[model samples]
Target: MKNLLVTGYRMNELNIFDQKNKAIVYIKRAIAGRLAPLAEEGLEWVLTPGQFGVDLWACETVIDLKRERFPQLKLGIVTAYANPEEKWKEDKQNYYRNILKDADYYGAVSNRPYEGAWQFKARDELLFRKTDGILLFYDEEMGEASPKFVKERALKLADEEGYRYIAIGADEVQSMADEERLSSFD
Candidate 1:
């Protein structure tokens, strides 16, 4: 997709470079800030409402709007994260809920509700096999994961397993990555 929205929470822990939650927040925000220029060229990255949380964007719609505004614009959607608890959340979940509804393709980085609306398990597996890009969702932030470790592990797993993205809480990024437990999606 020409545009993408990457979403997740901040890692909870503060130590462990890989697991350092603050790092995750800084990095995600940095990425979004860097991508701001792309918005002018038909791509943009938008962070979620929560601080050090999920990274999302309004690219597809922007592209569509761009197209409507400037017919020559080309566009696509590439979602990077989703929550397993999405089906259960009440008020704050609507934005995510809408992402699922509007997404053209899922990142499949973790488990998600199949009955709600979008169900891409099979497609996710196929994508994973090809190592192209699969749906991604961060697991909960553990009390002791490191940030660098999280990025390292995620990079390794994504390389080996064909994941498009890995979701991590602001506090758990590094440590969680090092922990590398089986994602519920698996």
Candidate 2:
């Protein structure tokens, strides 16, 4: 796929409040592993909803891949609505701003700031239309997680429209961490 939408749980949903949590490294590695093959297969852009967790991590992963390996891979931050960080803490807002600064393209699906859940649905619709596939960092066991909504939408479209949807779950991330630890001894 040429364009891919990378999305997943928010920081609160993941219970990861601190940005420097060492666990983030493993998450990024898993994302990179998933994307590398896609990049080789002509994945040109990674689009994310710009949430504070996997979405921003995915952006960093894409940026790292662009700098170190796949120069053609680009990051796009498309939020559900404007002012996505308005209610966020100072540090979190700054982080979002920096991610936007590095983005190849940035926009809000809804021009206005968040009004209701409708904006999020609009975002999914817009992103699905623009992207050829989705890479979701979500687990079905997180039953009430925000990513579940996105996952449901992806599943519906995958069979009906032949869209691609890839999910990287806790097992995959744990494996990535294991791989990283094993490789460090080399």
Candidate 3:
């Protein structure tokens, strides 16, 4: 069995619940949700804060708990709110970038799918794509898909197109919707 990590929305501040204990409870629930299926499969699941809320303290607590409870689990990072619409808003680009650079694998959870986990951070992957430019338009009506599958397909296209960078934007998006990518399995 393989280990996996699933990420979602999270509020890192203790003030969100008016108590530190409440924050812990919220984190605990999130941890449980990821671990439940992994436990049944005898596979390990590691939980970390989604890109939306990379609470330093909360993140530390989750890591500490994982090390204490399941020291041998595999790790992955989750991305939230896949699109960037607000410039003033804090984006987890930095957080997601770190994970993509360092983690074994990553997944982006959104209405539509993306090509690579690194795309979430737009780090090395973008440079690798050799994109002339990235156009960010606010359609507010574009279709969305699974990040995991999308990323998987992107990688395949990269191999097929002999494009170490970017390839088959549409096909990769389709693969993600079809659930064809599995980076964790790699």
Candidate 4:
């Protein structure tokens, strides 16, 4: 069985509420569609950063998929440091806690407090080393600086490690929908 790492932009970066949350809907559908084949192809675990947007969405999707089809699928929430959400608002912290509670495994790459960018890099490298593949949701135009940097690093590491890399952006989602529509007429 293969383990997959998931990464992507946060809600604030995606302008999630701009289109009546259509972007979020698209992201969920796209991720689910991509994950279906992977699950069927022996995907056993999904590792996520436990962030508020793509990571959380992927974790939820994996949980749903486990209930609906892939019974053996498991989720792991990986953080850069212990209590990573310490500075977040109450609601955000609650959400993060709930996600960790629902996960099959949860741990931080660093046992100590977050030092700086190094901790984040360490976490990213740890995720890359632990998983067989990566599922990334990214868009260059989104202006999500951190996610974009992570995506680039993941891609580079994946290439070096021969790990499978799957990416879905807003354009890809639109293209997929267009392809489906075109296929319906065939």
Best by TM-score: 2
Candidate number with greatest lDDT: 2
lDDT of each: 0.38, 0.89, 0.38, 0.82
Candidate 3, 1-186: lDDT as tens digits: 342323222233212422244334434444444444444656454433233332222344335545566555545454443443233233444544544454444554553545565555543243224322111111112233333343453456457664322112333233443443365456
* Candidate 2 C-alpha error for residue 101, in Å: 1.3
TM-score of 1: 0.33
The sequence of per-residue lDDT tens digits that candidate 4 reaches over residues 79-156 is: 888888899888877877777777999999888987898888888888888898889998787555567777777778
Candidate 4 deviant stretches above 4 angstroms: 17-20, 174-186
- As a TM-score, model 4 comes out at 0.85
Model 1 segments beyond 4 Å from truth? 1-8, 11-29, 37-52, 56-83, 107-149, 154-186
TM-score of each: 0.33, 0.92, 0.32, 0.85
Provide backbone clash counts, one per model: 42, 0, 7, 0
Candidate 2: lDDT of 59? 95
Rank ordering of all candidates by TM-score, starting from the highest: 2, 4, 1, 3
lDDT (Cα) of model 2? 0.89
**C-alpha lDDT of candidate 4 relative to the true structure:** 0.82
lDDT of 2 by residue, 1-186 (tens): 899999998877888889888778888888998999999999999999888899999999998899999998889988889988999889888888887887999999888977999998888889999998899989877667888878888899998998899989988888877887899999
What's the lDDT for residue 24 in model 3?
41
Positional deviation of residue 176's Cα in model 3 after best superposition, in angstroms? 34
As for lDDT, the candidate ahead, 2 or 4, is: 2
lDDT of 1: 0.38
